[model samples]
Structures are given as structure tokens and as C-alpha cells.
Target: MAIVTMIRRDVLTLPAAELGPDNPLPPLRPLDEMHRIEDRDKEDLPGDMARQIGYAPLHSLLPVRVRDGYGRTRAPRDIDTLVIENDRLRATVLPGLGGRIASLYHKPTGRELLYRNPVFQPACFALNGAWYSGGIEWNIGATGHTTLSCSPLHAARVTAPDGGEMLRLWEWERLRDLPFQVDLWLPEGSDFLYVGVRVRNPHERPAPVYWWSNIAVPEECRVLAPAEEAYHFGYERRLRRVPVPSYDAVDRTYPLNSVHPADYFYEVPDGRRRWIAALDENGHGLVQTSTDVLRGRKLFVWGTGTGGRRWQEWLTEPGTGGYCEIQAGLARTQLEHVRLDAESEVSWLEAYGPLSARREGEWAAVVRGAEAGLDAVLPRAEVEAAYAAWRPCADTEPGETLAVGSGWGALEVLRTGDKLPGTPFEESTLGDAQTPWLQLLRSGSFPEPRRVTPSGETLVAPHWRDMLESAPAQPLTEYHLGVAQWHAGDRAQAVRSWERALQLSTSSWRLLRCLAVADREADHHERAADRYAEAFDDLCQERRDDGESWTAATAALGHEAIEALVATGRITDARAVWHRLHPATRRRGRFRLIEARLLLAEGKREAARAVFDAGFEVADLREGAESIGELWARITDEPLPAHYDFRMRPGHDDRPA
Candidate 1:
């Protein structure tokens, strides 16, 4: 084994002899057959791994080392030694163990990173050792990471030598992320990695699944993205809950929450890989993954900020931690909802990128096996116009940025008069399973007898009012109430309701999710992040391979809420709900540009450029310059015509309207 040691910031390479560059090629296996690899193996194998034997082989094993202008290694000195051999690569510690490996040839920019070795490497085994047997392979760009990995079965796996570890991989297999193609490429010399999860799935059968990635950061450190609209969440006194805020921007330099039990979900879309990099923000030589894009995948970032002074600022409390995973991914058990099937192959998901600290780039996701025609997708123009129209009215009227909401939207719903009625409280005695909360109330169990009487002018509903008032409330109910409030125009009341709900339910992943919604509305991204993490755990458990509540009625409501969230630039949050909720909840949009608008918000010049560059992408309105046009139209009752004299654009046509 090559022993590479570094006391400085220079990059180092491991010798071939020590790296076992000539080890027997991994047996050719099919993508489906490799699903045996476990998450732990997936994390440690390529980087921070000791033996290359665990990884399977590709068509070629080209070996190379990374260096800078001075012929010095370009990677961080602390990053053990990274060795790339053809399609297979390995990393070993100078004085430690293993490290992360990057794809040598195929790299995609503005998209989430998905190392194939763990999922597709071994799949070549079943193809008589042919790496691309029944699969398709294409190059993204010179510096781009490998982006295309599709399977005949829509499933990929990774296994250990002794059959110890196992993990499964699936994407766009069932027509989910759709109407667009997965474009993974990188701009050479850029400091950030760009990846995107496109949508190409047909609108016929939308499939939803809980999504997340298990990311392993190279070092312990702080995350420096943007706090202008951050939604922070984490354990409160060791409880799994989150807090939601309203239009509040945090000024802390780094992430405030510690890294003990790290996890979260973003309300953004999976779009062009934006700024997903591990920068030593504090110049502490720390590495962190900026994005973990899994449509419906939970987001988890765990690390110790308590170790160094830079980190300490982020984590002010005693239990402030680090040294673990600045990571994110869905829990294993939550994999049920995500499935590989025929009708679902066309369902697509789009994720946005972090263009700037304050905003993110959007993604146009397409289904897996649907037609390649452009008509099947949502155009970029509509997305821009929608964003422009959906911005908060206060934001549109400068000096009008008034306190309009509590975190949850309850007040908004009540004030706007769009609040949906919760189950009637008088029906609490109806325990026939034919009514809502009948079983729980009949059995005197939790979340039972959801109902409430209208006190004077206040209308109370079962899941809404009772759940909100109950000592141990129901997160879903709070979210609904907040949604109603937002619809009703009581924005400030909704924010307050959601924020209060966040403090009440720490163990409830549902609460975490509600917090995400409220945070997004209030424009408090830090708090939204916190709630997203908690919701991730719940999402995993709720949806998996084995389907559970697929009823039409429940699905419809879920779809409506998800669409509303997405229209407002909460792509990640909408995706999470889409994955967990049943088909009834899936809403097929005439145009999907919420993600692109978010990219504009992040200040990703390239990403925004790409959105505008796409011949089919155009915007109709200029949403107060603070929002995208498409997003604005979708959210509020605005006069966003299909075409406007001021660079008017079509809602669905990528061409300028």
C-alpha cells in the first residue's frame, strides 16, 4: 500500500504498487446484481478505502494522478491518496485509512454526484464482463464526473467481496424526475461541481419515492452557502424536531447546528449541479459536500463544528460537534416508495443548484423511458414567468416587506379565506374507519378523533384545529393548517402557526416537513433546512418498496400542496412530498420552471444562462426583480399573460411567447 503523508495543503498521489493498480478486475456484473453493496461500503470503498478488491471493473481502467501548474498535487494534502485506474479508482490514507474517489472520465456539471462503482461497477458481471452490456454509456465533459448510469432493470447494486455489504441504486426507472433528460457535465477549471437530475418521465403515471444520498465529506468543517433564506433545523435537547421562521435571515458565518445526528430535506428541485463543493470556508482545511440531490431523498449533513474556532462559531452550545458526516441520504428502510417499474420510467424530477449563497439554480427533470419529444416536458419560459409572479407581494412593493406571516401559514390561510376545513370535531365519536381519525379516536390512541367545533367565526377542523390544539399535535395537521392560512392570505399568522408547531413536535418527522414549508414561505432558509432534515427521516419510513396508503383522495390533497410549494420555489420540499405521497397527490404541471427560478435566486450565472439559453426556455413577467416570472404566475392571482409586451413568454412553450 502506498503511504502518502501530507502536512500542507498540496495534493498527493498514491503509488500504483501500494494502490494495487494491477489487482484482478472486478468480476463483470449487471447493474441489478450489484445491489448487494451496503451504505457503509459505498462510503468507504472509493475514498478512504484500503482494498480495491471491493470495487467492480469498467470497460477500461485508466490510471492517472491530479496535479497543478507547479506539478504539485492539486488535491488537499489531508485527502489521503486518490488513485484512478481506468473506470475503477481507490484511495488510501497517508497515515489513516481510505479516501473519496472521483470518476476520471465521465463528469456531469450542475448535477448531484453519483459514483457508479458502488451501484453500477459490479453490474457488468452478468454481461459476460462487458461493462456496458445492456446499458448505455455517454461522456458528459472533460472534467465532468460520470453522469449516465441507466439499467435495463432500472436498478443498480453494490456488493462486498465476502458478501458483507450491500446497497441498491435506482433513478428515473419508473418515469419519475420527467419530460427532460439527465445532463451531467462540468465546466473545466470551475471551483464547483455541477450535476443535475433531469425530468423526462411522461405525465401518464407519476411515481413517487423518498429520496436522499449518503454523502461522506473528506474532512470535518463548516458549510458556507447562504443564510439570506436559510431554514435551519436539528435536534432540540436531543429530540428529532425542527423550528420554522419567517422572512428571517441568519447572519452566522457557518451552519449553527452540530453534526451528531445529521439529516435534512431541501424544498428545492434537483437541477443543474450548482455549487456543491467542500470549501474550507474558515480556511480550516475542511471539506464538505454542498448538495445531496435525491428526488425525495433525505438530506443529512453531520460534522463537528465544535473542533475548531471557525466551526465553534457555527455551533455555540456545549454539545456542538463535528468529525462525522457532513452528509445526507435517505434511511435504508425508507426505500420502499421508490420502485423500478414500467409505467414509472417516464416520471421525472428536477433539482436546482446553488447559484449563489442567496439563491439556487433550477433543474428540469424528465421521466426515465418516456418519449424523447420536447412537447412532453415543462418549458423553461413558463418556469421563469411563474417565479416572477409568485414572489411575496410585500417583496414586490419595496418598503412593503411587512411582517405578513407566522412560520406555518395558519394566519395566512385564515386571513385569505382559503383554509380547508379540517374533519368536524363532532364526528369524533364516529369510529368506523369510514371517517377520519375514527380508528385512533375509537381506540383512544394518538392522532384519533380529529375534529373541532367552529367557535364563533373561527372554523375548526379535525386534522387542522384539533391536531393543532392537541398537546402532542399532528405535524401533517399543522402543515395543512399553515397551507390553508397561506391560501387565505394570513401570511403572518401562518408563519407563527408553523413556528409554534415546530417547537411542539421534535420527534415527528411530519412536523419537520411542515417546518420546511413554513420556512420557505417566511424566506428563512436556515430553519427550513433544519425541518427538511427531520422530514427526511419520516419520508424514508413512510414510503418504500412496499407501498402503503395509495388512496386517491389523500393523494389529491398531497399533490395540490406539493404543487403550491414548488410554484413558490420550494423545489426540494415539493419533491420530498411527491416521493412520499401516493399518485393521487402528484400534480402534472403545464410547465416546470420553479427550479430554474430558484437557480436565479442563487446567482448561478451559468445555470441561469443555461435556462435562458435553452431555445424552449423563456419568461413572461418580471416578478419585482426578486422572483422568477414563471414562479410568480403559479403562486398568486396575478395577471401573467401567456405573452407580455415586456419580453412576454408562453407558459408552456420554451419558445418566447
Candidate 2:
């Protein structure tokens, strides 16, 4: 029989903020009260454009105390961990963290098939920030980590047909206003773990539905899949193309030996088998094979460099080692900008387990073995037999229920109708702050400044202020309030709020940078310079502490700080900061333009011109080259070089650069 049970264990404890004397759990404000009229007016527009308008109310406005990277401490806390076991494999799930698979162990070799992060360390990696590395993160509704990534999910244990055990986790994806469920089954004596996923849209209108299972494995592993080309995204989301495995005179194989990091999304050849595997040099690794429901495959590489290592540390911890991700998506690519029709549901099954191969050539053989074994073990007759022999086990809890004889092992999931305590945001009530905020956040658009009502009569500011007042000590609350205040043209008050936020959470690079921007916009040049300098220093410290190489985000922040210093006539300080940037960042066209500008300001026209010439020769410039070239021409009063190509590159379409 499959073993399934839930246990609470102390893993990681995060810093907790104290709520004021006011009630910690306040009544959720209705959506109408929470959102201004502008939010509703923009509802008819496409989802992606609406999110950009920034009309969504900020639900995280409530203050919660959290410690900085240095001051934070980790302790054990009781979190429910679901354990599912069979003769060949054992798996664990953390229902509290979006029902994320915490561990998948192959009992035969006693090796972990999935990377299991020992600690619950969160870093500023996800779109909304606060992403934890390792395991499989179920991303639905919008790209990056979904709003539910770090949130808890409803869970249950049920007896599958044929006495097999199943662990089910379900949650309402507020951003998409849909419900998603995942069922994991481990039949007795089977080597593979079966994962069935269902996403339902009960609404009347069609909406975009995105799903990606992000699976992490050890760094330096080779990923085997059927793909001919891969799209690479560089700093600032620059897109490029190269052949899969070996491309563009560079080896694109996994567990890369290259000095530079790589981030790319690959589309599988149409009609190819839906399978991907990451095998170490020894041929022991993890394999994920899904039904036709999942069609896209992706590979992300964080090179073995100082910057990459530091990023690894931030996501996990020191000495825990780094990992890479092999992702599977439902659409042709990630969040394919598509929509799901109303009152429809999409479901699929995926199988995952350990794959053992002793040599590189045997990788395909291993995959074949897994495929054959799956077919043999879970044939239609076997499934029918299992369904007929199903019986409730003693471990079956009351909250967990089961259905039999459903097509393709389908089970009926009863919504718990339970509201998550303490936060009104996850409640399904239309009037709750989450409804409109989620609608805006998921749409990828925000209202324009002119569309919003006058700052004095703003609808969201008062609610944010109320939350801040109720949790005066929470830094995040202050941060949100500062954002609202800034939008209201209260720059001074915004600065004050941001300053308090920084004081409370010194390690928050986002807060520091926002404060710096506010200072810069307010014409407080020296203050802005100081803030930028401090932020840069913090980034450097993190790099040093984590042994990470320079990242594009940090480099961009550094560039901003140095520019601020230069603006303040602190050329010497700017030079020091510029020199400290990584060599690769220094070679970029954007930084070169800044360098030329700096040289021209210092009255070295020839040096500036030489810098500009060199930059134009080597840098692709992508989309930004024209603007930088224009600025260069303005600075030097000279024409752009004849050889410089301002036209877009073949693979570099208008993405983010």
C-alpha cells in the first residue's frame, strides 16, 4: 500500500511583526470601497495592459516586521509536511508553501530526485519578490512565481482506487479568479509518482490561464529533451537565439562549463514526446514526463560564477550548493499570452521519478526505460482494476474524500469554503481588497496618471494609510504607503515613509532604491547620491557575503548610483563605483555611453569619442543603441559611425530591452 500522512516539523521561522493594539484581522473592505472608479473603467481593456496602469490596490500594505539578511534568525516552526511513500519512492510536500514538493527521494539508490532546500530562505528573485529556490513550484496565472507561490494551500489525503494513496492540494488563484488542484498518487510497488493537475475557470468570460511546473536539480547536470532551438534572455530581458545543445559556436549543454551565465526558454519541436530529464555525469538524475497537456519545456542556467554563486546563497544558504531549473509549461511557451474560456477546465497528468544512467549515451535509454515502465505499470486495465478494488484506508481523514470509476482517474474536489485567517486578501468575497487588486495585478496593466482621481480624493491611499496606522511598525506597509504618497505628489511624505521603511528593513534593496528615486525626483541631489551609494554598498556586501558574481540587476542599480554621484559633481566617487563594476557590465553599451558622458563632462572629448567608437563596434545595443547613439552624438557634436547598425537583430525582437 502507498503510505500517506501529514506531520508538522520545525523548518524555518521568519521574523514576525507585531500588530498594533488594533485588531490584527480587520474586516475586509468591499471591492468598491477598496478600488477607485478608474479601476472599473479599465476592466474592459486587455488583461496585460490593465495591470500596467497601476490602478490595483496594494494588499501587502499591512506592516509586518522582518529582519535584514544579517539580523534575521532562523528557528524551527511547526509546518504541516505531507509525506507520500511507495516501495520505490518517497515524497514530501509542504502544503503551507503552495503545496510545493519539498522532497522526492528514490528509495532504490537513496538519492533525492529533486533538489530539497534545507532552509526556507526567500530572496528578491520573483516578479513580486520573495521567491524560495528548489523543488517544484506550481506557477499558474501570470508568469514568474504566482501570487500563491508562498501562500498556504488546502490539502487532504485520500485513498486512490486499488488502495493506492493520494495527496491533494487545492487553492483559489486570486489573480486569475480561478481554482487549481494538484493530485499526487503513489501506487504500491510503482517507481514513478503520478501528478494530476486541474485548473478550472468557472467564470462567464474567457481569461488567460498559465501553468508551469518549475523543477530544480543540482547545478552542472545535463538536460535531455527534444528541441532544435532555444531562446536566450540576457540582462534586461534581451532575447537571442542559438541551436540547442551546441549552438552559435558555443556549447549550450547543461551543467555548463562557460564562464558567463545563461537564461533561456526553449520550445519543443511539435509532436515530440513530452519529456525532459536532467542527468548528472554519472547518469543518475530526475525525469519528468507529462501527457499532452503540458507542451512547453525550458532550461535556465545560472553559470558557476561569483554572481551565480551568491544568487544561489540568497535563494538557499551558504554551503548548500546551487541548482538549475527544468520547467514544463501548458502552453507553447511560458504564459503564452493566451486565455482560457469561461466555465472550462484543463487537466493533465505528469509522471516524475529517478532516472539512472551510467553514461551520456545511456540517457535516452533511461528515458525509454521510464516510459516503458510507466506504460506497463499504469495500463488501462490496471487502472480499471485499481478503481474497482479501491477502499478507504484507516489513515483517511474526514476532510479528505474520494470518488470512484471516474474517467482517467479523475476525482471530485470539494471546495473547503474556508477563509484563510489573518489576511482578508485571499477571501473570495467580491468586496475584499484582494478582488480588485488581484484583477489589476494579474492584468499586467495599471491606470494612467490622468485616469486616476485627484490625489486628495484617492480611494486607495486612505486604505493603505489605515493599514499603516494599524501596523505602524511594519516596513512593508510604510513602503506601500510611500508608493501611494508618491503617486499623490506628496514627495516629502513619500520620502519620509520610505526612509522609515529603510530604517526598519535595511537589507531591502527595493526600498532603498525607491527612496533614492524619490530623492532624485525631488531634486535632493546629494541625498539621492547618498542613498544610491548606500544601496550600491549593500548590494556589494551581499555579493561578497554570498560569493555571487555581479548580476544585471545589481549592475543596473550601480549604474544609477554612479550616475547620481556624477550628477552631484562627485566624479571621483562615481569613478570608484564605476571601476568596481564587473568587467562584463563595463563592456555593455549602456555603461559605455555613461562612461563617454562622464569623459565629456571632464573635458576629455577625444577620450569620450574613442569610448563611443569602441562601444558601437562591439555592442549589439539591441533596442537601446539608437537612444544611446543619439545621446553620444549630442555629447560629442559628431555623427554616429557609418558601420553601426541601429536596425533590430534577427532574434532580438521587441521584448524588454
| lDDT, candidates in the order shown | 0.28, 0.57
Give stretches of model 1 more than 4 Å off.
1-183, 187-206, 225-259, 264-278, 281-657
Query: What is the per-residue lDDT of model 2 for residues 1-657, given as tens digits with 9 covering 90 to 100?
Result: 544333233343433221111111111111111112254544554354345334233333122211111112345545556777777887877776667887898887989998878777554344333457789889876655564555567666555544445676666664455566777777667777777777776666776677889999987688877666766654333445567666645555565554344555665666656777788888778878776668778877766544444356545657877788898887544425345787777777777877664434543464456445445544534433432343222223424422111110010111223232211122222333233233333442322222211111112334334444454455655666676566555668877887887788645565677777867766788998988887777767655321222354456577788889988998877887888788756765557777887787778888987886564322212221245546566666565443442422222232211
lDDT: worst 10-residue window of model 2: 403-412
TM-scores across all candidates?
0.23, 0.54
Worst 10 residues of 1 by lDDT: 63-72
TM-score of 1: 0.23
RMSD of each: 27.9, 14.1
lDDT of 1 at 179: 20
User: What is residue 214's positional error in candidate 2, in angstroms?
Assistant: 0.7
